[model samples]
Target: MDERDGKHQDAAQPEFRPYHHPAAGWGAAKSVTEFLVRERELVNGPRAIMKMNHENGGFDCPGCAWPDDTKGLHLDICENGIKHVTWEMTRKRVDREFFAAHPVAELAEWSDFDLEDQGRLTEPMRYDPASDHYVPISWAEAFALVGRTLQELDSPDQAAFYTSGRLGNEATFLYQLMAREFGTNNLPDCSNMCHEASGRALQASLGTGKGTVDLKDWEMTDALFILGVNAASNAPRMLTALAEAYRRGAQIVHINPLVEAASTRTIIPHEFARMATFRPTRTGTLNLQPRIGGDMALVRGMAKAVLEEQKSDPKALDVEFIERHTAGFAEYRALCEATSWDEIERQSGVGRAEILTAARVYCEADRSIVSWCLGVTQHEHGVDTVREIVNLLLMRGNLGREGAGPSPVRGHSNVQGNRTCGIDHRPDEAFLQRLAGVCDIDPPRAHGLDTVGTVEAMHRGDVKVFVGMGGNFALAAPDTPYTSAALRKCLLTVHVSTKLNRSHLVHGRQALILPCLGRTEKDHQRGSLQATSVEDSMSMVHLSVGMKRPASPHLLSEPAIIAGMARAALPGSNTPWEKYVEDYDRIRDTMAQVLDGFEDFNRRVRLPLGFRLRQPARELVFRTPSGRAEFSTAALPDVVPVAGTLALGTMRSHDQWNTTIYSDNDRYRGIKNLRTLVFMNADDMRDRGIRRFDDVDITSTARDGSTRTLRRYKAIPYDIPRGCAAGYMPEMNVLCAIGDYSTQSDQPLMKHLKVTVEASQPAG
Candidate 1:
């Protein structure tokens, strides 16, 4: 092999090290300047960053809230986040000429990263079959067409409105309003794909859809159970809290199939080279690597261990809290006692000793917190897994404590906020009743379609029109081939976004692209500047103001886009849609009138750092139907390995944010330039007769006669558990079938799939 090929092959090898991963937000050198040049279109680079930070104050970096040294006003965005910011602020324009030069068919073959890197969509465009290109259309014409399509639908259910968590509260509220005003409550946000399982489990157990702990709660917690999450890369700001927890003698236990860097020591750049270069920041006290799709088993083992320990020493559990505040403990205890340790050990890949040790630590701690992200929620039995985790916490009376509760590490800045502000498929009766009062129109009481339901409807031709508020639907979904085919069945598709993405290429017959304002841009409505609110994972609501100017004068705010669409869809509807757009407070006032937590939305949201929503459970108040906390006992046995098969997980690259790709570089894995590859255990690779750098094919055994195969991927061996493998999603989505989704939450189980792999034919 040549030097370049040899270097690439060498870099592809997996090196299992024990150091903390690179800083995700603030540690990358030149991240700010690079962002200014690429995302902000500032010719003066660092000068632009300085000006924005001083006078306008650069908007919260449009990145993860991994804490920065705000005292020193240093920029704290990560490598990927910098790329995300720069990508959004990019001057690269995908105008009519760009479209005219490339047909939709040709663009479809381009990688997801390449398609988005071309830059922002500058004008409204509609797909034309004859020309095979998206031709620019007049705004008036586009809105009229959208109205006509929605109006022609046989029923409101025939069309669906989808929202992404990345959207601001103002935009999400307006988008939901448009759907409700159009006579359908079919509003499903991106949460339907990621954390719906967490919401379901938490709401059923505690009567709250969000986490019971706030950011301040960390200060009081004695121990933290970081389950199925990689906070180091996904949310680096969390490391600061964890580091503090370590310094305070709070034990942190990390559970995941991957031995991520965050579970080790990290260098804090903001702390200066004094500690950064010499000493690594301690992140976790214990690290456990369970098998893929084995979270349920691991959690069950933990609960079982807790129960067994409590039997020997009654003081091991919080008997007072359990007797006073919980129900169904007897049945749950019986189930745990009957569960076999051999089964748990086989599935979790962790011995009884390890589980008992973790359980003892949790029991001894006055306050213990459990936090998980997509890892625990993106499985066939994700809901049960979360329910079991709650069971473990409840056994020790951890619910509603200062540092003890379940925390779902949410994706996207405003995903949780989107759900908070009425972007739900199944709105509760109380929330719906309040919403009806706001608009003076009775909203739909029946449940609406979720992300999977919407896709299925489109596939069955039951849905004719699809409207996306912000996310790239085609790219975020599993089974890319099936999802693309489903999109083709829709008669009309509308995408309101800031940049050009792959979803735009997989279009309906009459697809309309609506360009909207980015979070980094100043939002001007009527005569005043507007600010939007985003709810973090801790239920802390904060106000975000844009510093950069609009990428284009023609660009409209998401709220305005929804209002314009509403005007067209319902001509002469007496609702003051235009008035609400002019003033967002009026919108917040209406929202507050309908939602219980925001009694003083306008005044409360104006605070320097927004107000926290009222959460009774944070103080240990149970609002369940029984007026007590509930415990569920369901033990997940190991997935019996077939004669020849493995559990594969679909993941995102470090250079990627959801479906948007910044580059092919995955710095943590030492991967750069290329992304089409899978990471597998070295033993598994050898046993399957697959060699390193060998082109391999992964085929999914669909229940139907059809088979989906992802071809020509290089296999890179790593230190993963046996029977566990991982490949990047959107590309390997083809392996996931249409019906292969979680039954309870309807979220796609993209993280867990059964597949067979073999060598692919060499390129002729």
Candidate 2:
């Protein structure tokens, strides 16, 4: 039994058997089947919902932001996608009786998986502090309560609107519009926590925040460099593309602290012949395990090798492209030359020979693509590191062409769409002006708070009302204890969600749980089914039409709920909240008029695979102040090894999606029935006198001299860099300080936590 939540039934001694099977082959198939049976959705759920996922005129998978395959495979769903769909389509319901039987205090003690496992929320529920339980409340009453609270706030800045990436384009557009029209730009969102660094760095380097490549580029690339991204567990669909790239002999180099199993080899479940024979396809041609926060050094080393090769082979560098389309090359080249090989080897944990080998592959390739995820963007120098990657790409003239560019793979399905639809805390003057003209309202001109800023403001008593459009903000935010306490300080907290999560239990003095429809459920508006749109990682905007009946009749669509709140909050407002809710096309029409690159939104989005938003960077059109791509000259990060401490990074397990834990097992890493285990290098474990399954206390000291510790966590030895460690997030998030965020993007440095582990007890 796990003492933490008192629910897990696995053996008291955590299992650590190495998984020899290839990822997403038999293991994925079995996992999918098990989830279906567990959710009692083995029949029509998989047959119908699974087919609709990632297909034209079907609902998008509420999983990763990977672009859909235009080849239209019969089954495009991945194991995690199936898990998400089945998890949402679970038959279990959390109704009034369920809440009546359990008090909020009791529910708060339940584990995240157990709480969400209680299933879909049925109706709007309001917290009754006297009874310590949630009681059913009518939708109208809930809306009125939210409206009254917002209206009663001392200032509009006292309220912060939070958006999760799962929200669709139509709903997200309306959400931001409502917040702006209500005179507050405090629109803190999930992007602030995850990909803010990517956006900031890309916008600065290439004049565009999004990736320039589509799925088609994967097939055309000569070399693919994957950095700090674990595709198997995070975005399983990417495995298929990687396998194909491998078969086509594209040199793939995977660089990270841990050599992820999927990055080396993967079995594409959809490949019938390979699946029948159990043959795993090779993925990474070379894998580099660097120390945590050493990516900048590793990339700079590659640049140095390329520069050296340019001396001998003039073709090694695209001199003409750099001279015509880029600026600041001389400064960047000087920095690379000034940097020493000894410093690079010491910092990146990779030898000079290996760096040169990787550089040779990159230089020889006609076109190459570099892709990354949270690992690259969740560090103190995340923005600088990404800019370095852009520098490497620009040296080879990899941008503005097929099969080349920087790819920041997003985690959430519509996360990119949310930002595209104006879910930004700091909207530009042009965007705000367009929105104001389209909506016929004077929007707020002041910049709003991001996730970190919102938490700080709440703690300082500057914020009162917290409105979460979707997401488990309490658990997902860094410094879990601080965030929870900050949330409790709010006068009123509201969550518009499809299910009960930790954020619901960790509430304010007065809280409202406004239940909403999930992505798999049919959204009925004005007696007709409605479809929403989402933008994938490649900037492809496509419609998502749900087919299944809603978990409950009382659950309204996200757009409907936002409209209700807007109407109740601003009774005198002239925005057509009701009309937009009735016809989603109205939302699209207004969005096209407001946002760029959506000129023919309604008509174009209805086409076969929707439409690709115009990426100026892809067309070699730089919108930077220099009117060209800019090479960064930022100094390399200080990556010297600290005494008696290991750099730790938090990651999700195979059976997890963001903050939602599906199970305790991490299939790819071979961690079973446990989430509190810290993975350490064998050498480090031996040196520290810590054995496998030993209970160890991991502690981190914040810059403010405060310390956070995770007590009695099992320490497991694994294949990783000597001075680097890995652990599951949200559990390890406690060790991250609230102020420990990237200086440039304000994204929490979840991937560069400095921690020390001390043995608490030997394996029992």
Candidate 3:
């Protein structure tokens, strides 16, 4: 009866509709191809659409990192990349006799969608601890026990590695060429845990860590904004570029804390000639919401109400592009005219005429953009809330031009091409002198470890080998019982996945798992069959290849298990990891001789659908270090010592994606069945004495007083926003605290999280 089940919601709410979706966009690509043929058993439907656009193509859809719109081939997929290509072309597998019949504590109590639908794992395992399970080994004893623990580590900065932009671009350029030829730059990734505070506040305001618009910069924007992102379920084709900037007459606005229905409209249904000719599109013209960690006090009170409406209107300020291209305008206009309006309307719940009507739509936009995601880099002053949206787009003269700047929106599918093919945990000396002139050694320049300094250096034993190369890092890490006890005090962990998670049964004292190949299969190398390269979320860079074939037959190809563990750990390096896997254009000509808009990397990633990179905000160029644009110094407070508690936020569940949960449905907030639950604001859950389906326990504390909790859950009050609250994500990732992050890019502030609730168990 999934006739769009809870179709277009709002029946006094509580209506449900995800997992097997429908309300529109062509019944969401035919309810995700009928949940990929009746609940993900994907039997070759039209040979999976003729190998999803061939040319060696392996359906490049691991959800949202969106690019491919060379203004065509537009099925650029997203409802979590159609649940990551129907959960990787699922037809289920798990093999090796499903680990000789369960065990590993009964597959660590299932669910994470029944251990990823007990599928596609196939072989090469390890963790046996006397058959507690995970047997089959041999990939030459898993690269000779990972090259005898990187030649007994001692100090390659105690080995970390991490990376997980679903490793491609030739297994993250051969897993950062086996950690810079095993010398160190320890290499942490998952883009330093989600947009390293929008890449250190847009590479310190705008030299670029990437993102200065270009999805045709939302068609020459005249006003867009949209903060702390939810772009209709995390990048749903950026709701057709915010319905083409609300159909030409731009001005969209949005900001967030929850109000996402792709900001409001979107019914594409393959535009059935404008939905059987009814005509829809143009959504949000305002929206707002704010409050939970109030986006850096609501974008510095909309840049202090556009400098108090340009002090009695001096043409509402843009003073010749802030006096010829910006740089700290009079100490940020005297700290926004000595900040006050009752502390920016009680720390931004909005109203100083909605921050002076979003500062007169950014002073009547001449070209604007602003964008954001992971709700402004998951907070705690997320890089001063992304430099207060780059001080409200450099108080006019928005960095660069045509539709202005600051985009962000990245989340894998080459999470920004695994840090531009290096997998940096920090590394610059012109990318280690062009990787010491293409792998002739001498790489490490110190600085590494970032996913919270590699989980506080693996809980302080200074990490002894972990390696990931494909995430689910113990359920997208952050206090999942302290990241499964810092991955059971690692003494060698490894994963290189293709499915079967819960961090491969959270093992350690030596664990493995291998099982590679799955971008939708078929990779093959050495015998001529390669083609990788990723980079998206607008900086372009392309070429991918895999068109479904091997889900098994002993998988492989994460650049052939990182070049067979870098030819069994460096046995005298001189990298050519077998001539870049027999031609991935010699790893895109050695990642264009050590990366940076890859200097014509193999004829611009084979042109057709790749090549753009160079976005100094599309030419108006403001590479910061004083060649213009700067202005920050005015955001010195966003206080949050749980002042009368209740901030929360954490999200994900359009049948989930990150921390991959999938079905405990959240069909545009009319939840179904439930996945812990929480919501709030039904009169702030009746003035904090909460009720409707009670079962509390959310805790929080930290700043060293360590509190944390999470338990029972189930709150549900609804229409959030009064000092907000909301939940979901690796089961409320234990009410936040992987060192409650983001004091300039440590990034774990899982959408703010102040806490302080009571009743731990009531309406059972």
Candidate 4:
């Protein structure tokens, strides 16, 4: 093994202790302080930057996609938000000197955390295979190289453009426009891996794909059903809303295989009175632990219970709304009625009594909200599960009303906005016509490759040039080994990134690292300070203007980088690429003309809390082919458990963001200094003759009859349901095959890996 590989090694032995404390108290504060100091931002840290996060006219946090509070409360940041800001505002630099000292091979051996911890990239760098290192390249040279390589491709389809949620609306608009004009719709993004199922299912059911509820709905809702989400870590800012709702006598039901600490209790750090008194509020009134891949059956069971109660009292369901606003209810109701209790129990791994209890809660509430994250989307039956959730909400007349709807909690700050700005592989025909009329370019009509399709295309040698707008694609994608191999097959790869990550190391024969300005960094173009816009999970669009100076003078904004590449690659195009870069308003102006719901983009975006895009489903307007919200009759997933394997789900740790590890600890789960530990049920571990902290090898078989293994992962007994196991992502992502994706949405089933575990021998 290389010596550099050992630099950020995990603890020699893992430590396990049950953490009984509420989420987000002194513990969260301490973690935030430690990260600020470690990133060298302590003295001039969170107090200054956090004040601007999610505030009016300030930069939106590059964290989760939770909407900003309408009241604009002071210190509108969470612990994870603080970590994200400090991590971006670090003083460390990964300049030419650092690359000169470390070869690409050696850096490849370093952990993901260490690579990003090296700090921000200072300038453009290109891979020199002869020297086995990256050397600095001028911006003009970089642009010329990218253009020359792209122009040389036999077909425009030979290139693929990927986007990350970190980009703002203006940049994403230019990015998609550039790619479509360049003649391909091969725009795969982070959404393909996480919430594609949500969008696909929601769009099918309700004409629109976005959530219907906003932050204010949380205050008025009588019941909140949080499904398959780990709120404490993934969306910490959401805890304040949950706590407030709990305090106001709202019924909160948490349904997941694992009993997450944050779902049970929490103390909002910003609430001075509660923080000082250490009074923890109970966030969840009921917690349900279903087997992995069992959400569809559980949701069906709840529907069945509701239907049974409806037989006794017609008021149990909003019959009037169903007849007036929805279609396919009769068939859906029949499907639920025909599903027997025994079958529901067998498939869901939940008792009928408990399912009925949850159903009763939903039936009693006049207004209800159903929210979910990756847990509900990263499954083979993810789309079906999401559709079932909508069916439950639809039964209660949840659409087009305040405090009643579906909320697919997005993780990335602007992932939802990326989609809103037209970052799609298969854009609709209306959007294309409008874009063509507005931009005077004929876009390709052919459907393009998605994330999984991009990998397949690259492997088949169809794609030659790959350009990423701002994400660690290598680590974020599933089938890590397969994705890496596919990435290497590209003729040239480019990443517009803020810091060094795993994607930089696993490169194509030729690669370019184009460092861009972070969200907290000021973007000054042509002597004018610029601001970009992003859309939150609730469809709220707002401007984000950076307050801090750029980490390096050479760093360019994402818009500038996209415009540079577009100008170089398509010199013959008539689009005003240079003008778009000079001022972002030009980009927004064009976007307003092209996109729906952004007619007055520039003026509306500058409003106090920005503007709420038109959500048709929120106003009882269904865009579906039937012109009504449709009830899904999709069958329950065949969840027959394999006798010897456990259903494992990949998750993020408390000290981590999506695909970015902040530390080797999961404080909420009571695990310390380890990222390779698998949380298993105590009975399951005992049944398998595995003890706590025992080194175990986990093997998963793909649908193609091929198997992958992760060796020597410590097995920790925890409170998860039997026949299910949980582990941190990216590490376990290797076990997820590229072919193991939702047939409906094409999202990798990262949350449903059927694996068998056995004790492994210690290394000799």
List, residue by residue over 571-626, the lDDT tens digit for candidate 3: 88777787777667877777777777688689876767667778664575766678
lDDT (C-alpha, whole model) for all candidates = 0.76, 0.90, 0.73, 0.90
Tell me the deviation in Å of residue 566 in model 3.
13
CA lDDT, candidate 2, residue 756? 89
TM-score of 1: 0.93
Q: Point out the worst 10-residue segment of candidate 3 by lDDT.
A: 1-10
lDDT tens readout by residue for model 4, 405-468: 9999999989999998999999999999999999999999999999999998998899999999
In candidate 4, stretches whose alpha carbon ends up further than 4 angstroms from where it belongs are 1-8
What TM-score goes with each of the models? 0.93, 0.98, 0.35, 0.98
Per-residue lDDT of 10 in model 1: 27
Per-residue lDDT tens digits of candidate 1, residues 1-764?
Answer: 00001112123443332233444424354444555655655553343344322213345445553322323445443455555666777778888899999999899766666777788778888999999999988888888999999888899889999988778776777777778877787887788889999988888887788888776667679989888777766776676678778888999999988877677766555566534355555878998878887777777878887777776888878889989888999999888778788888887877888887887788778888888998888887888888888888888888766677877788677788889888998888887777777687667878889988888888999988999988899878766766778888999999998877878888888899999988778889986888777777777666667767787777888888888889889895777888989988888888788767877888887665567888876677777898777888665745645657778888776667777766566666656566677788888889888988787877767545466777777788876888888877667776777778888778887888877777887667
Q: Summarize candidate 2's per-residue lDDT along 71-112 as a digit string, tens digits.
A: 878788799988888888888899999999999999887888
Instruction: Tell me which residue pairs clash in candidate 3.
Output: 25-269, 26-269, 56-546, 57-546, 57-547, 58-546, 58-547, 93-119, 103-106
| Model 1 poorest ten-residue lDDT run | 1-10
Q: Which 10 consecutive residues of model 2 have the lowest summed lDDT?
A: 1-10
Evaluation by lDDT, superior candidate among 1 and 4: 4
Off by over 4 Å in 2: 1-12, 761-764
Question: Residue 443 of candidate 4: its Cα lDDT?
Answer: 97
